[model samples]
Target: MAHEKRAYPLWTELPYAGKTHSPTIAGGVEPDAGKWKTYFIQHSRRHGFKKLDGRPIRLAIKDPDSIDWYAQLKVVQHTLENLSDQEKRIAEYWSAGPPTKQWIPIVDRLIDTYAIEAPRAARILSAVFGGMNDAFVVCWALKYKWLVPRPNQLDQHLATYICTPEHPSYPSGHATISGAAEVILSYFFPAERQKLHRLAEENAQSRLYAGVHYPVDNTEGLRLGRQIGRIVIEELKKDTVNGLPIERSSREFRNADIITRTYEQAIPFDYKSKCDSLLIRDDESTGNSSTKDWIDPKLFI
Candidate 1:
């Protein structure tokens, strides 16, 4: 895809387009593609070999080729063709920077609205973002393995709300990340289960609204992402402090008890200065989460 030199080009097409990642980049076609640079490999290694439950926590992404090709294209065409101006604005609002980092603010707002204590909120963010990253690893692997073309490739005249990412289109990265986040966050904040999941579904659909992904891309991505998230949840539940599960009860996270949290597409002019606290809370200094001691993962969810 040729770079469109316009004001704020980075927003339309981020530097190093988040989805440029391919399975081949991590050593082409290795059966052990699952082992390729997973964040948990280093962080969870010391904790001991872990699995989703009894088996390996890997996503079996559906082969896009198996589906009817024209049927999928019709979905893309319908979504793009009927996309209203308001829907485009809404979709653009949901388009997280790849590899899907926009979920940070949403998480932050949730924390603030719930007034969750520092330690608890840290644990929640860590698990959710970690799961998302895990999903991305699998998503990229399947993306290059399938090498499915984007909707625009089939029809060049298709107008997109944002620059279509340069990558194989089988699994939508946004959908994958959203799926993982939805599961992990819902686990910790089960009271917000309905809202959290609705957001996840919307996030997946946003790709279609942007005219970037076919229907199957969002569909399979969401499924794969949820599986990855469950694995992370299983691992998160293993942690104990004073012999109690780090995972808390849903009763404590009731919607009535917490303030409402909402998200929008707006970015503050001084976003750089304000993001430090809202996005990645400086929990390391305060020793907010035990997971941070080892992983110290950056929060993208």
Candidate 2:
């Protein structure tokens, strides 16, 4: 099998970084990537509402020699070559920061939109973050265990649109977190299930558009994340009062709806601009705020 071969380079060097630094086979960034596993191991020792067991969550993936692996690589190459303007925007949008950075704002928006109370909102945040943490832990364990080479590592000629992250590529962190967030948030806000799912799919596909991950990486990450999310939901159900599961009522906030509509109606920002510093300007001629006003201008920088 291709995985057994020692000749093929694994995720060893930073591809996007120029040739100045020495390429040693030492540990890449976040050598302690699997340290989060301890959180689950020590959960019982500490005070917590739910106890999550991550041992049962396993990811089964195709080997590098399989036809499906090569086909997925071809998909990544094709996506990079034929990326549309919208695809490029999507990639750049999700590439702003760590997966959690983007998700925090989304959760906040959902909380505000639904006018959730303090207790329910806290539970929502706890479940979402817990699931994400578990996803990262399990994802990193499999990532370093498999040591799968990234798309660029497989093909040197390929130039990614965004800088590749300094980690082994098999399961995408962004996609995993997106999937986990989607499932948990959907369980809380069933009304926005379809829209939440679309966001998750877009987040997963962004990795492909950026040429950073293979199709299987995103798909498996989503699957793993969803499984972990379901587990989190089940654990949450265990917390009951008076022999019944605790529940909260969510009231719709009309102002949040209007704000969301206005924000979505704003124009998309161009990421290729050559601005020196962060600047927000209004189009006085049209009496409308520019895209920068609506979107996070920091992401462009």
Candidate 3:
């Protein structure tokens, strides 16, 4: 299907044009395919119309510092900006045309029901929902350092989930952040670790699916995420009562336990129940919870 070109707001398109513009309000001008749209739109008005393709937008951010010099070689900012553009495009495409509406209810239900009843589980789900923030931060940080190019610039035939980012590519931040959050959640839900791991991997792969990340960048990001997760797990292990992690005994685990108890198990939280409030305090105080009660194994053991 072909997308008709829509008239974009002038301010929005200027940033996308990647010019040496300071953080100022945009002048009322749209981008022409041939013009350099930056701090000020420079053009050869006197002579016949011409465009200056002097250097890529990414390189112009660099200054003459030792750090800047190393950054030129590394291409950090370039990669970050490129990946960010890719992510934005992916999100926009998905928002414009979602695969289905059915999953939204399911995911929303899962997030709400589990968050209060099972806070840790809620955190896990939340982490999964918009966890890409970390990846974006990483990419933005690196983009300032490195100025690499997307695969599309190198070769046009590469199909992507979103349009290729207009910057450098290295150290896939999406993969790293997604992997980190997944691995951390996995410790609480060990049985589902494999599943979670796959989910994280797929999330990274989605970048590839979107056609923005190279295989190496994504792989490196996943590796970085795993390391981050392991560290988090170690930290959380210390957040326990008598060596037992409190997050494991949270509401989701209890719900899971109730499910296992009987086919006729009652739904846990009712309007008048004090158990809801009780558990909140117990968790806050680092009090030991009995293992025999209904516990979600993914969270506890």
Query: Per-residue lDDT of 158-180 in model 2, one digit per residue for the tens?
Result: 66666566567778888887888
Q: Please, what are the lDDT tens digits per residue for candidate 3 over residues 19-111? A: 333112222111121232321112344531221332211211112121222223234234434554444333323212121121233234434
Would you list the clashing residue pairs of candidate 2?
none
lDDT of 2: 0.63
List pairs with backbone clashes in candidate 1: none
For candidate 3, the TM-score is 0.43
- In angstroms, the error of model 1 at 120 is 2.1
Residue 78, candidate 1: C-alpha displacement in angstroms: 1.8
TM-score of 1: 0.69
In the range 124-238, model 1's lDDT, one tens digit per residue, is 7777777776677677666654556666555534544455554556788888988888888788777788888887888888888866778878988899888778777767778
Q: Which predicted model would earn the best TM-score?
A: 2
The 10-residue segment of model 2 with minimum total lDDT is 273-282
Best by lDDT: 2
- Output the lDDT of residue 210, model 1: 68
Looking at candidate 3, what is the lDDT of residue 18?
19
